[model samples]
Target: MSAPRNTAGHALVHGWKWLDGFASFFGAVVGGFYKIPGTRPIKTLLHGTWPLGHPLHPMITDLTIGGYTATVAVDVLYLITREPGVGHAADVLIVASFLTSLLSIVSGLTDWNSTYSEERRTGMLHGLLMVVASLGFIASIWLRVAGAEQRDLAIAVGIVAWLVLIVSSYFGGEMVFGYGTEVNRQAWATPPTKWERLDLSESSLDDRKPVVVKAKSGYPVFVVKLDGTVYAMGNTCTHAGGPLNEGKWVGGDRCEIECPWHASRFCVKDAKVHGGPATFSEVRFEVRAAEGRIEVRAR
Candidate 1:
């Protein structure tokens, strides 16, 4: 019994290693296509509409998991009972899951590209594994629909596909838990309650140009004055900590500021995102004027 158990454990380990290697190889090939100069235009087009900052990955993952689980359960029952209706229903769900997985991959990659250097490699790995898992599930579904005489073979494929999905999920968990990927950077921030004076007695800030100022906590804050109203927000771009003070302001009243690095735009009034590559809003600070001096405080 001990010998058999040890053999099973070793086989599992070996299979996992092989799967990892295969995923890495294929991921590199796919990633190369995405890196091409011509692909940039396509990526930009897709990312422009994608909600990169709203935690789309988790939502996608949940949908994929639900669909896959339902498909697996239906497939298992179909195999055991030889029910064609159950198999047909499972086919529909499997196809839906595959399509969802493809969209998730696209959205995930869009966010991954702008991530910190420390997170890029591991995130690439996690995404690679998920792609492999998706492909396996697709193949399994194809084989099932092909009406193969040996139903057992289809059942075996489904089992393998589920195993791959499980492993890919584990890698994704590591990317979030260990590396803090997609976590809100401003979650721990405490905004100032009292408005601190802005030393803008000089005419330099009178033009309503954006300026960077240090708060009492020494954190950099971006300030802009429009129509006698002063607006302040965190100077750091929530996407990649790019200098928001240096970003270009577009249009009037809308207060849209676009990040120089990734072109992520945010509204000045509510700090809400107006464009892609940044899903989270900048931290907006409250401000007022007292005694001919401009003052701002965090909300």
Candidate 2:
């Protein structure tokens, strides 16, 4: 809930620091759940790291939010017109929204598991609000399903749920625009346009051992030799800017490296993400050896 450094210009956000303690504990639980054997595959899909190359939570959240919004509109119309058709439409929309909410929760948790500190706290708060709102919506649905007598009560409950959803959505936006959660760490990285020489010699690099070198553009590059060929990529992991050099090599035939922080994996050859929690590829640098020294350029 507290930091050693000064926290200014975040007055409203700082007030929510009390939630950080809970976030740390729950975040550890989420991290442990994913670390369990046979769960990584599910985690990968939830993160949308493979096919989408972006976080999936944001992709599906709109469906749930939109559905609920439409349901609220129909509910208001039912209140004014008392039309049976409008009421039926509202019922259908609430059901669809409830289902999609489950999806958004799963994907959001998958991404939140990789967050830390203030981002984790904000995400936890956001998730809590969403869950509460979803439960309220579920109750509203149950009331509507009970009988026609409870229709007005259902509409009231649904409207309250929508308001909670709106507040929760604000926290979700803060996690992105404010904290950059699940955002591509290397998005702004500019690879070296020309060859850049490193201070170390080729012989100095131990086979299969990763090293960090700065490109002409001052961006760090991760360099490693495998099977007598030197490969280079952005040293900053696309997941959360974890130092790739600090991470260990993983995967036998895949030429993958695991991020030290969140365990996200990336292919060394193409810099493509090979695991969850990291949806963007690292910036690959073309590498070569000349006069026993290593050189790299943007691919």
Candidate 3:
């Protein structure tokens, strides 16, 4: 038992050692392909079509491939019975997965080009492994079609592909969690919750320019005035903590303020999102005029 345990532990360590070198080398090779100057423009163009107010490429790729991978085990079981209907169903799933894999590859390349150097390398490794796994699955599907008798071969290939995908998924998780890829970009925000009394007696606010004030909690808050009404929100932009007070205001009625860094816009009235690069809304505070002084409370 001790011998077996030692052997297993050694294998595990050696396995990871090999994986680390392989992933690093392959990541460097693939990352170089997307580092060309022309790739950035194309990737930026694709980013425009991404859904959910963030980069769309990653989301779509995950959905399409994740769905297909999830269904593969069940499909394999159905194929084992040699039922014509089951085979037909599996075929549809395979084709869908293949098409999605193609789409993922294209969008992933675009995203890969824009990533930071370290993240790009890690993302490249994840992408390369996924591509190999996807190709293997595709070939397995071809074999299955050629002869249903090759069902076990197809299942074996699928299992291998699934294992590869698991490894790729781990790397992908590292890209997001470790490297901050496609993350909320605004997860550490504190919402407006306290009422601050504005010293309106001071003449500095009369010009209607944005003013920064400290909340009771010592957090910086931005205040602006329009039509005798004062509005307040967190001074920090939800995306990357940009200063929102200096941002340009567009139009009236919950005037939209655009972040200078990433151009994320938010409404002054309720802090609702007006535009992208930021999915979360700003923190808004309710204000009341009292004896020529403006007092604010969290909404």
Candidate 4:
């Protein structure tokens, strides 16, 4: 179902559809950087794949947004009270906002690198708006630092930055609430609870190659054999619903399955996410060789 069209947010995202070309081009450039050798660890850390097991961008954004919001509020107080200390507090908040926004931009770029199509476009628009706001705030800080005479102009710039931040936040919401970006692909999956036979027989399967099979529940299962052991998990990737069966086995030591769409990796044995853009783990299942066929059930 589409989101409600009655709101101005819907209009804003839809009206900006012309920006898709630029978004795609810029996203590809960022995507290429992450694909470079020796960048996986840094990308994975920014993705918050291992320790946090969730996207780091959204978490850090809270601090960035809060700092800017506080700055706006304090600026308003300065206008009302005309207290020198109140104006100084606003300046400090702007500086803090600028610093946190830099972290937000880095983490946001890491997450945005994997997006495609409409999600990519919306994300790029959101990111660009944030960059502009950051720049505006930086200018505001410089003005404030220059002298007391420029304080009023600095507050005006800070207010403009806050407004842009609000608009960008709306697009960010559209990406999540509308496009389901960063959402668990199998969040609503129903794994078979009973022994469900697979369509393929034992002899037809190949080692380290993923095969997609459907259970009695109609949910897709990814089946693979490695080192004489059979493993089964959700066939749909938790990141973007990419077919896991189409991806290749990666990490000689880790034994991970890398999603073809975004390179998200999940451990073959436990289905834990070993790399991201994927924050959630694939749902694992119990499998067995029975009557010349492989059968699986929910664990």
Candidate 5:
């Protein structure tokens, strides 16, 4: 991305550009972490659980931030009211937030790997901000665990860290709302309300190759013939709108197709995503043959 010209928005623009560089460097490092063996279980535990139909990262992040905010509030009350119990609770929460953040970082990174180029740039910046905030909290935790005198310093550091984390969360929000990360593939799609007939005859169904057919409402659907059964799904790839009809069959799987642009794989039978880059499943349609003609309907 080229640097924009100096204007009313120059400072904001340049600040993001600098952050883009930092994110690129930091993402390069996280990419290396993938090389460490025995990471599958961790990926499954963090990403497989879709709390509230959203990725685990943001939910975990909200919980972690909530814990941090509670710890900060507890620290303030402990100082003002001279409650030893409050101080102890704050320490426990600080550690708890740190623990939850580990899973949040992992899940976020897993999703980030599949983000679009523009969103990934912001994703990395959000990650870097969290990293800095983590360091502050980790430092504060060390001091809090050391005892009473260090507790004052811990509170000071923790308050600052909590504020930093809130800002980081804003960037994270931008990645989703502003950039459409992890959103449903067909959220904006306007598929036909009623079933539409496809020109292909039932007897002419071919295996492993995809054909694009327009639905009654004009949404392009990817129709693939596999053995005797026919599969139909939205032609657009869920990840970035790459045309699925133009994509290729995933090797070894006749019922699956891979997006040519990003290689996001979708199962033809039900349009379920077995692999991603694409966190969302492909938009599928009900396909059947009636009176020798093939028809597809939005599901």
Candidate 6:
């Protein structure tokens, strides 16, 4: 079902689409939205280089959520035992959570600047909530350091902040599972296991030109012929499902297909990433020509 057009957050996200303009303006003035930095290494690192195939922001979020939740656990323990040491431990956790939240906030903003359309608007609200949560934690720290009389109130606010953080996290998940921001495009995809016949005549394919044809399993398969040899891989780009068949050959040697959408380059020979914004490799396939037809299957 389509999302509610006039819901509570409608104005905040898409009030006649005017909010998009303001958001675009804000992002451009602050951090050059939609213009991913040309520095490949830096963009790769910030975008999705660490944690093997995952983005760094998600890795850092574990600490942010864990540290904040730890403080709540300590707070409850203090309330139950009336132990001063437990309160002290809660203070430490709060401070740590605040620090890690800074990193999470920064990484999130970096990702946010790269996001577009409604997802970008949703991310803005997510980041704002995180900032509010951070402020609450900082305030809790100040109050705890001030005196014992403020400890109870500080814990109260800290718990409230933790709650807000949870809500913000829900939005984050929505962005990924719902809008597919920074998510692997082929995570649920399954290539055909058995050999599948290509619909086109082998002679129809031109050398070095990629063609997108449906495999037996029906998922799009990218087929390319080079040097009298045919190659096949998943038609969907691993980065964002951009049509690889529509992409142009890159690397000046025709070894890669540069995605037209995000410019994520994949090696035509192996489907491995030859560039940034796509950490995962595309699914490779084996192909053979028989008589007048081309056949392919998952590798």
Instruction: Please give the range of 10 consecutive residues that has the lowest summed lDDT in model 6.
Output: 1-10
Q: Which stretches of candidate 2 lie over 4 Å from their true place?
A: 1-9
Clashing pairs in 3: 50-56, 195-296
Best by lDDT: 2
Model 3, TM vs. native: 0.63
Give the per-residue lDDT digits (tens) of candidate 2, residues 202-268: 9987778989987667889899988888899999988878998888778878489999988889889
Candidates in order, TM-scores: namely 0.75, 0.92, 0.63, 0.90, 0.85, 0.81
Choose the strongest candidate by TM-score: 2
Lowest-scoring 10 consecutive residues by lDDT in candidate 5? 1-10
Error of 4 at 211 (Å): 1.5
Which residue pairs show collisions in model 4? Answer: none
Instruction: Score each candidate by Cα lDDT.
Output: 0.68, 0.85, 0.64, 0.84, 0.76, 0.77
Task: Write the candidate numbers in order of decreasing TM-score.
Answer: 2, 4, 5, 6, 1, 3
Q: How does candidate 5 fare on TM-score?
A: 0.85
Q: In candidate 1, what are the lDDT values of residues 134-200, reduced to their tens digit?
A: 7778778778777757456666776687778887777676556655555555666655557787665
Q: How many residue pairs clash in each candidate?
A: 1, 0, 2, 0, 0, 0
> By TM-score, is 2 or 4 better?
2
RMSD for each of the candidates = 7.8, 2.6, 8.4, 2.7, 3.7, 3.7
Deviation from native of the Cα of residue 46 in model 4, angstroms? 1.6
Candidates ranked by lDDT, best first? 2, 4, 6, 5, 1, 3
Residues 97-176, candidate 4, lDDT per residue (tens digit)?
A: 78878878887888877776556767888988988888889889999999999988999998998899998988887777
Clash pairs detected, candidate 2: none
State the lDDT at 201 in candidate 4: 89
Candidate 6 Cα lDDT to native: 0.77
Which portions of model 4 miss their true places by more than 4 Å? 1-18
After superposing all C-alphas onto the true structure, candidate 4 shows an RMSD in angstroms of: 2.7
